[model samples]
Target: MSEQSPLDLAEGDPFGPHNLPYGVFSTPDAPEHRRVGVRIGDHVLDAGAAAHALGSPYAALLARPTLNPLLAAGRTAWRDVRRALTAWVTVPAHRPDIEPLLHPLDTVTLHLPYEVSDYVDFYASEHHATNVGRIFRPDGDALTPNWKHLPIGYHGRSGTIVVSGTDVARPQGQRKAPTDPAPVFGPSVKLDIEAEVGFVVGTPSALGSPVDLASFEDHVFGLFLLNDWSARDIQAWEYVPLGPFLGKSFATSVSAWVTPLEALTAARVAPPERDFPLLPYLDDADAEVPGGFDIRIAVALNGQVVAEPPFAGMYWTAAQQLAHMTVNGASLRTGDVYGSGTVSGPERDQRGSFLELTWNGTEPMELPTGKRTFLEDGDVVTMTAWAPGPDGVRVGLGEVTGRIVES
Candidate 1:
């Protein structure tokens, strides 16, 4: 009897044909020659090789070492390529040529799929923002006056974004306490993780032209899991007048795979109701499609699940974020990425960051490993998520994990 094909995945595999997320990978035999790859079951299909073997017109786009080419091809091309890819792996007649291009995922090295252009992270979760405010300013309102009016965000360092599995060296910076007269310099004693979902920009927008809410899908390619590593001590000291700098810039980890935006059709839901009237540019009350996604995220420390933040509860949506981000006429580039800042729900167990989970270290969570408030030097934090897919299938967003190392 012939052996079963690796392509024949078990029923309901998350990374099956419906969820063929893209990435960049290299084999041990040709480590330097990186190629664009697609995930299917436990294998990575060399997209460029498969395209070439099948005489696909997108061969040039997929043939590149990075995702930039395909990303720049815009929405139409993205759809066409995705359709072709789905057919390539699912249609049996093409299986003979495609099978040779598949490599065991474990045998390959995954790299940062795209060269990040600009990085921006937004405080879009009302629950997370409120929790943070209550923790920091007990006397004042839990949210800023501008919180509900628009999406609050800040520019981040793109150079520091690393692919999952990379070790995050503890950042050294100035930190101060309420009792300290002067700040002290040292490695962060309160390193934390911000569980986030990141959107990758595909087509570029013209400079000085604003991208409205309706146009979000035209320019964005996909979404992925992101861990915005933070140094809470450093942030507390420096984030008063300005915003997150050294505390957040040191490193941000992203999943190796990028789940295409199209695959998440079934995940769309209406965002939390707005408390204040939105500006015409920021309004989405009548958007043909709801902006929120139902991506359920799990934050795990040392392989133990600590929290499950629901993306559906976020007040601001990626569409609104994109509309707000480019509303200033700041042009969008092909590889620009923006994060849906720490997703948290109304419940405590749904909190997405160590800061809120531990209530700013005042409450230590008991885990099998030990009591933990903030991340230790050897702590490993992994975040994984899935969204509702067509026919009740679950679309996996993959995981982003990183170990904290001493500075």
Candidate 2:
């Protein structure tokens, strides 16, 4: 928590700012495959190398060739990594022993933070839910009838969650013709990005065993930034009966860093008040706090800022979603991923996705360079987040950077 740790801390650098997010990388020039690492002051300390230097149980997990095996070690090992990292990065510069482990960030190839086995996305933000509801239902009713009772979510395509710097291919799917009553096939014209936070599950639950809401935190290891790329035209045609299919399954982008929960302990905030009480099973008897992370989120298009919002605006919490998912006694496994649905604020300008930002694409978002509407090929999109705290900026997660690509 001390700001005077002899490391050059940036004013708002989330990586070193109390919260030490985890990531995978190899030195940029080393190889094509990624290796595990953590960020600190514009540098990435190779986890394997740092752990090898630390020795013992810590080294055991880090020395492994990949994070998938280490992630399978569960929470105890996960916590050990965080504790060791906190100590290593905080050492005074006078200590010459630690320099060999940390490497400059520019020299690393960031990879998908973890090997995700499954992915679930939660519609947690109240403002986002209400705005989207208004767009669809539009009779002055913002919350759906079932909205207050449970955390709504859907299973996502884990195979497509790529790391930053990857190019996203424009998806092609079916869309309805305005004049005709049928559908036609073509490349998506309404591709949009949803700003979100994704958490990684570190532990496992048996197929028929349920995880209680109160204990849901134990099942999670850490969080990261997620961009749930969507093709609106395709979605409109396919979502009516079954929810997002090829429209959303084609690609999703996430930051390579998986910022651990321990680093974010100082940034927890109480979840929003419920309009209606939750069921006894979903309740947190400990009652110390509701549930929510306090990470501030923002999105940018080709270096131009688009939206700056907070995760606090969410209607539900990850804990509740995890609890609800297992209510039917479904099992969960380590490396499972969960997304906090597009985080939007209550205001119009603060909307999280292009669908809302451009008012369903009716209004074009004017950029400084004079371009507008949905993303175009070669346009880059970036998302970043951090939580403010006395210890420094408790960075919740890192970011995802992508350029549009032709189909």
Best by lDDT: 1
TM-score between candidate 1 and the true structure? 0.99
lDDT of 2: 0.78
Listed per model in order, the count of residue pairs whose N, CA or C atoms clash below 3 Å is 0, 9
Candidate 2 per-residue lDDT over residues 166-285, each given as its tens digit: 999999989984576888898998889999988888888899988887776678887888899989889888887778888899888988787777766667787776678779877753
Q: For candidate 1, write residues 160-211 as lDDT tens digits.
A: 9999999999999999999999999999999999999999999999999999
- The estimated TM-scores of all candidates read 0.99, 0.92
lDDT of each: 0.95, 0.78
Model 2 per-residue lDDT at 224: 81
Please report, as a residue range, the 10-residue window in candidate 1 with the lowest summed lDDT: 3-12
Query: Which stretches of candidate 2 lie above 4 Å from their native place?
Result: 1-13, 92-94, 139-141, 392-396
